[model samples]
Target: MPVDKTSYLLVDGENIDATLGNSILGRRPHPDERPRWDRLLAFTQERWAQPAKGLFFLNASTGLPMAFVQALRALGYVPVPLSGSAEDKVVDIAIQRTLEALGERDDDVMLVSHDGDFLEAITPLMDGQRRVGLIAFEEFRNSGFHDLVRQGMEFFDLEHDTRVFNAPLPRLRIIPIEEFDPQQFL
Candidate 1:
C-alpha cells in the first residue's frame, strides 16, 4: 500500500530545548530555566504547524516540571505521558507506535530532533516511502544523523528560519531569534 500522503510531525521536547537554549544562552542552562520552556513550546508550535500535522511528545514519567508541560499544551501540542527508559526511548517508542498504527496511511513523518539515537527508529519509516524530516538546529551538524536528513527529508534549523517569527506573530514573542529569551518570562 502507498504510504498515506498526509504529514505527521513528531517533536522531541528535550532535543528542542537542547538546541534552542544553546543558541539563546550561548550554552546549556544551569539551575532552573522555566521561562525558556514557554518560548520553546511556542516556537515548536509555530514552526511545525507549517505542515499542519504536529504532534509533540514529552516523557511524563520523568517528572517534567508541570508548568512546562502545561505551556506546551497551551501552545497546541498533544502531550502523551511516557513511562519507561530515557526520554529518547520514550520519544522513539511513541514515533514507532504512531507509524505502526497508521501503517500505509502515513505519508510523511517529521521529527524535531538531532539525536542519532532516533535514526534507527526512523529507518523503517523511510524504507516504506514515508518522507522523514528533521527540525534540528545548525550546531548539531557533527552528528552522523545528517546523512539521513540529506537523504529522506528536509532539515529545518530553528535559528536559520525566521519565518516562525515572520507570520502575523504569536500572542507571545517566541521567535525572531534575538528577542526569544525565555528567562524573563519565567
Candidate 2:
C-alpha cells in the first residue's frame, strides 16, 4: 500500500534521538540531528500524496526546556508536551492519547520511535481500520514491532534511508540548553 497523504506522523522526541544516535555504550553520539529531520521530511514528501502534519511528543518533566520545543515549533512540528513521574512513560501515554484522537476520526498515525511499548497501543488502531508506521534505527528494532512494521507500517533506518543523505553533524544536539541557537553556539 502507498503512503497515506492524510496520515499523521507522530514522533517520540526522546525515542527518535535515542534510536538515531543511541549506542550500546549509552548516549554515544550522532553528530548532526538536522539530517535526520531532513531525511524524515524528504521521506514524507516522496511517500505521502499530501503534506503531512508532524506531531512531536515530548516530556515536560524531563526538563526538555521550552526553547527547544519552540525551535521544533519553528521547524513546523506540533509539540505535545507531557508531564508525569517518568517522561518516557508519559510520552507513551501521550502517544496513545493522540492515537485515540486520531482513532475517533479513523485517521492514520505514524510513529517515529523504536519503543516497543507502542506496539500494543497501535495494534488497536490498525485493527480498527487505521494505518501507522514506525521510523527507527536497526539496533533498537524489536522483533515484536516487525509485525507492525510489515503490516503497512513503514520503517526507515537512518543509515539506509536516502533522505537522511550523507550530511553528518560536527556534534550531537541531544541535550537541552538555554536559548539554543545552533548558529550562535555551533
Candidate 3:
C-alpha cells in the first residue's frame, strides 16, 4: 500500500539498548524494565494525532532474536532485520538510509535513538513541511538535537514525555520549576 502522508516511527533498537545500559541504568535492563513497544506506538498516535507505522531496525549478523522479533510483529511493527560483516553497524546504516529516503517522501518521522550519527540525515528533514521528531531519553539524547529543536524539530523524552513505559524508570533529570509537580515525588 502507498503510504502517503503516513507517519513513520523508525526505531533503532541497538542505540536505545546501549544508551539505556551505559548511560541510564549503568547495567543491563531486565525484560520488564524495557519500554513497552505497544504503548510506544499508542503514544505516538495520540501525540501526533495521526496513525503511525512502526519500522523497527535490528542487526541480525550474529542471529535473529526470534522472540523479540515476533513480539514486535505481534504489536504491529515491521521488524527490519539486516545482516552484514561483523564490523558493520547494520542497523544504524540502514536507518540512516531510511531517514534519507524519508526526506523525499511526504511522511512524518519520529526516530527512536540517542545516536548522533543520524544528525546529518535528520537535519534537512526538519524543515516545517513535515513533522520530524526525535524520541529518546532526554538526558542521553545526542547534543546535536538541541540545534534541531531550535530549527523546529520536536524532541520527546521516551519515558517522561511519551509515558511509554509500564514501570517508572530510574531516571534523574533536572525538572523545570514550573513543570515540576510535587505529587510525582509524593
Candidate 4:
C-alpha cells in the first residue's frame, strides 16, 4: 500500500541555537526569543499545501535535555536525539543520512538551518523534481545556499517569512522595497 506523501520539515537545532547565541543575540536567547515550533510546522503545511512531518535534530551526547525534548514533542516535533563521541558532529551526520534516504521518497523537504555542511546532501535533491526549501535568516545563511535560489530552491526568512518567534530578531537583512516601512525609523 502506498503511504501519504507528507512534507518533511527537518530542523538543525544545534546550528540554530549556536547562530542565535553567538551571532544574532550575542548571548543565549531567553525562552521568549526562541522560535515557536508550531508556527514553523504551520508554515510548512501551508507553503507546500500538504501535511508536514516536523523532525528536530539535536545532539544528545551530553545527555538529552528532557524539558526541551518534551516541549518539542508537545509542539508536534519528532525529536531525533543523536549521541556520539566528543569529536563527532552527530546531529549533522544524522541529518545528512536522513536527507540521503529521503531521495527515495516523493516527499518535499524543508531544512531549517544556516550551516553549509548540508550543501552536498541537499544539492542533488534539487534535481528539478521534488520541492526543496531552506528556512534561515538570509543574512546568516551560507553563500552556497544563495546560489541554490537560481536552481529553483525556495529560500525563506525564518523570522520575517514564517513569523515563528514571539520577539523580533536582530537581523541585518535587506528588506524588499514592498516590505519597507519608513515609519519605524521615526
Candidate 5:
C-alpha cells in the first residue's frame, strides 16, 4: 500500500548503531567510521514515499564527535541531544515525549529502534487516525515487542536490504594525537 501521509522519522541513534554494528559489521567501528547517513536517509525517504523529517536522538554525555554531528546535519537530520542519565532514561524519555506531542498531528510516525521501551509511548498513538511503523534490524525479530506487529504496526526489516544501510568497513587509520587531522579523516 502506498503511504500517503508525511512521516516523522524518530531514530534511536545509539540503539540502531549498536544493532547495525553487531549484525552487519560484526563489531562496532568507531563512530567516525559508521553508517553513511546520506544513504540511510535516502532509503528511508523512498520507503515512506515522502520526505521524512528525520530526528536522530543521541546521548549528550557520550560526546558525539563533531564531524559526525556535522554529517548528520548535512544529510538533513535534526540531532536531538539529550542528557545521559541512567536514573532518568533520558533518551527514551525524550523520544516518548516527542512521540506524544506528534501523536496529535496528522502525519505518520516511524520509530527506528528495537528497544521495546517505546511500546508504552507508541501504544496510544496506534488509534486509526495515523499510521505508525517500525524500522528495525531483522536480528531483533524475536524481541519481546512482536505484539506491536499484531497491533497493526508495519515493520521494515533492515537486514532484507543490507546494501543500503550497512556501511562498508572503514580503513584503519592509526595516527598520533599530534598528527591527527580531522580534514584528512573525512
Candidate 6:
C-alpha cells in the first residue's frame, strides 16, 4: 500500500461522535464541543501522503446542527445525511454502496467507524487491488470486526492520536466552600 495513493475516507458520523465524545473524551454524547476537523484532516493527509476525500455520513433525524455541518464543509468534507428512523440503515447502506463504487477505482479506501456492520463492505474491498483500511477507536480492539486486523486491514486508533481528534475539554474552576456566600444564590 503506497502512501501516495489517494484515499477516500467514509465516516459514520454518529457512531464516531458517540465513541469519541462519550467513551474517549468523557463528555456527553453530541455535546456542543466537537473534534477539531481541520486538524484531523491535515493529520490524515500528512500521514497518508495524499489528500483524502472525506465523506461524512450523519443521521438527519438527529437534528444535525447547521453550524456543525458548515464546519464540516469548511474543513473539506462532504456531509451525507441519512434519515433518522429506527429501522433506517441508510448510513450503513450508503457507506457500503460508496465502498463498492470506489473499490473499482485505483485509489485507496478507508472506513472511519467502529460499527461492525461495515465488515460486509470492508471484506470484499480487502480482496481487491486497492489498499483498504479502517480508522477507529482503540476500544474496538475487542469489537466483532477485530478479525479484520488479522485479515490485513490497517487499523489506526484515534485514541492514540488525540492531538488531532480531541475536542477541547471544559475547564474546571475551584472555589473554597467557606468563601462561598449563601447570599450569592439570591
Best by lDDT: 4
Q: Show the lowest summed lDDT stretch of 10 residues, model 3.
A: 2-11
Off by over 4 Å in 1: 1-4, 22-51, 62-66, 85-88, 99-103, 162-186
Candidate 5 colliding pairs: none
C-alpha lDDT of residue 110 in model 4: 97
Q: Each model's C-alpha lDDT?
A: 0.59, 0.67, 0.90, 0.91, 0.74, 0.72
The residue-by-residue lDDT of candidate 3 on 55-167, one tens digit each, is: 99999998999999999999989999999998889898999999999988888999999999999988988878899999999898889999898889888999988877778
Model 1: per-residue Cα lDDT at residue 139: 62
Tens digits of per-residue lDDT for model 4, 1-186: 966778999999888888888999999988888889899999999999889999999999989999999999999999999999999999999989999999988888999999999999998899876899999988899999988988899999888899999878777778789988999657
Backbone clash total, candidate 2: 1
| 171 Cα displacement, candidate 4 (Å) | 2.2
Q: Write the per-residue lDDT of candidate 2 for residues 4-106, one digit (tens) a residue.
A: 4466878887776665554432565444533455456557646755576788888888576788778777776788887888424888888877877776665
Better of 3 and 6 by TM-score: 3
TM-score of each: 0.61, 0.73, 0.94, 0.96, 0.75, 0.75
lDDT, candidate 2, equals 0.67
Segments of candidate 4 deviating more than 4 angstroms: 1-4
Superposing all C-alpha atoms, what RMSD in Å does each candidate have to the true structure? 8.3, 9.8, 2.2, 1.6, 10.9, 9.6
- Model 5 TM-score (2 dp): 0.75
lDDT of 6: 0.72
Better of 4 and 5 by TM-score: 4
Question: Model 6, stretches more than 4 Å misplaced?
Answer: 1-5, 21-33, 62-64, 166-186
Worst 10 residues of 6 by lDDT: 166-175
Q: How do the residues 76-127 of candidate 1 rate in per-residue lDDT, one tens digit apiece?
A: 5667667785535776678667766555565666666667766665666766
Candidate number that wins on lDDT, 1 or 4: 4
Clash count, predicted structure 5? 0
TM-score, prediction 1: 0.61
